[model samples]
Target chain A: MERKSIAIDMDEVLADTIKALIEEVNARTDLGIKEALLDGNKIRHFMPEHEGVLDEVLREPGFFKNLEVIQDAQEVVEKLSEHYDIYIATAAMDVPTSFHEKYEWLRTHFPFLDSQQFVFCGRKNIVKADYLIDDNPRQLERFTGKSLMYTAAHNIHNEDFERVNNWKEVEKYFLGNEEI
Target chain B: MERKSIAIDMDEVLADTIKALIEEVNARTDLGIKEALLDGNKIRHFMPEHEGVLDEVLREPGFFKNLEVIQDAQEVVEKLSEHYDIYIATAAMDVPTSFHEKYEWLRTHFPFLDSQQFVFCGRKNIVKADYLIDDNPRQLERFTGKSLMYTAAHNIHNEDFERVNNWKEVEKYFLGNEEI
Candidate 1:
């Protein structure tokens, strides 16, 4: 029997990229930008003056490597792995340094996922999977499969797809009454 | 209209990895193993005394980066890109260092191909496409697509799939009676 495949985005879906960005912003400058102020996906929108700050932060060697794992991501994904082909597909081309860092980070955090299950590419449109869970609506918008919007500070306002605010919600949606 | 997608392997199919291995063996050891003596995909078969030489060579920093490109791979792939959704799917997880090197090498050599077209993956079975051109019989064996065996020194003995000896044969099979 063919197992259903799920392609989960790394940055916002599994990794807390927004929290890291906020921490970096607060640490580097006196902007004191909080998560509440981060309304959209583009960091530049909140701080128009700091046009290149996001790019600078992304270019840092450990920016992606040091990101905190999302709550329950490891457990939920492991559960899903048993019933489906779980793929952690991340758009890592923007920062060349993040390639190996992300790979190591996945291995460190989600040891259950083998190296073969990781798909590091630039776009999500090329991915062929039965389901995609991502924070970016643009990625979900282009995906031909069932797109589940994983809530993030930047994507809270976007009501374009089926939303799953947390990993518990993800578990409920897929497993139905199964305990995590 | 949806274009037919073709997933092409990188190492032995597009890049001449055997040449690089032979060069590395000659440069590092006194055995001076030639291409004629190398029997299989694994280098350990030829050098029984140096059991870990293959792993050592693969772990080297520039092993995948400095590989020579297979003759006419660039031109044939470019021609194929005109009609099909061409994807360069390489099993890069064996060597962690290969992730970025393969990405950079693609950018440098196949300038026409964009970052979105490259799939740095582990198992080719996870890939979804209408056709797959690869040298590894294991990868092609499981792929649920039209598998075209790209002739490589290691895979030349395998007669499981339809064979394409060189880029000329590939062009003949695809763009028959049509000039590139």
Candidate 2:
């Protein structure tokens, strides 16, 4: 039998990038924007005047390396790996420095997923898998497989794909007694 | 009907990396090693005394961007794209700088293959495809799909998989009237 596969996004889905960015912005700049104010994919989108803040923060050496892992992402992905081929596909091309840092982050946090299970690319459409779990609907738009939108502050308004607010919801959606 | 896919390697298979490395080495250093002497995957393997030469040349900007296209690679890959999903999967994580350079190289040379068709990754095992065409037998060792060895100077002696000397042979093997 063919083993099923799942392509997972790293940024907002597995790693709390927005949360880290918000914390950095609040601490570094005069802008006191809270988490609730961040309602778009990019932190810059919410604050057009402070657009450079996002780029400045991301350009830091350890910005991507120090991101906190999303709640329940490690456990849920570990469980999913038992039955499916789990691949971590991240759009790391935009920031060239993040390539090795992201690779090290995955190795340090999720040791179960070896170098072979990671994909660092520009776009998600190049990926071929049975399912994709991502925060951005734009990434899932052209996916030929089942697209599951992991809820995020920016994507809360988008209602195009099946929604999973958290990792527990992901488990219930895929491994639930009900048919998938 | 499900469309068949083929994952192709970029370095020695589609791009003449070894040739470029040799040219750069001879032009910059006193080492006069020819292409025939390059028996291993890395240029450093052949020149153990001048081991740093490989790293030094690769670190130069546009090293990957300025590589020559392999003979008939563009035409053959274009032909293959008509019937199969052609993905250019390169093991580019070793050099972080090569990520964007390789991406732009593909965009400049093979315009037919969009960003969706390119995969900049570390290991080929993570890739999901019907077939994989690569020069390194080590990359093809654990692949579940049909593996075709593309002939290269370093991998010529390795006979673990079925070999194709050039793109013409690949065309004959895949879409020719005669059996592969």
Q: Which candidate is the best by lDDT?
A: 1
Tens-digit lDDT string for candidate 1 (B1-180) = 988988999988899888888788778778877776555455656777776877789889888888889999899889999999898888888787888888889988899998888888777766778999998899999787899999876776788999998888898888893653
| Tens-place lDDT digits, model 2, residues A1-180 | 878889999999999998898998888778887777666555676667777778888889999999999998998899889888899998876776677678889988899986767788656756778899998888899666899999888888898999998998888776772433
Instruction: Provide the lDDT at A26 for model 1.
Output: 75
The C-alpha lDDT values of all candidates are 0.85, 0.83
Interface RMSD of each: 1.6, 3.3
> For model 2, which pairs clash?
none
Candidate 2 scores a chain A TM-score of 0.93
DockQ of each: 0.62, 0.32
Model 1 docking grade? medium
User: lDDT of model 1 at residue B116?
Assistant: 81
Model 1 deviation from native, Cα RMSD in Å:
2.1
- Report how far off residue A45 is in candidate 1 (Å): 1.5
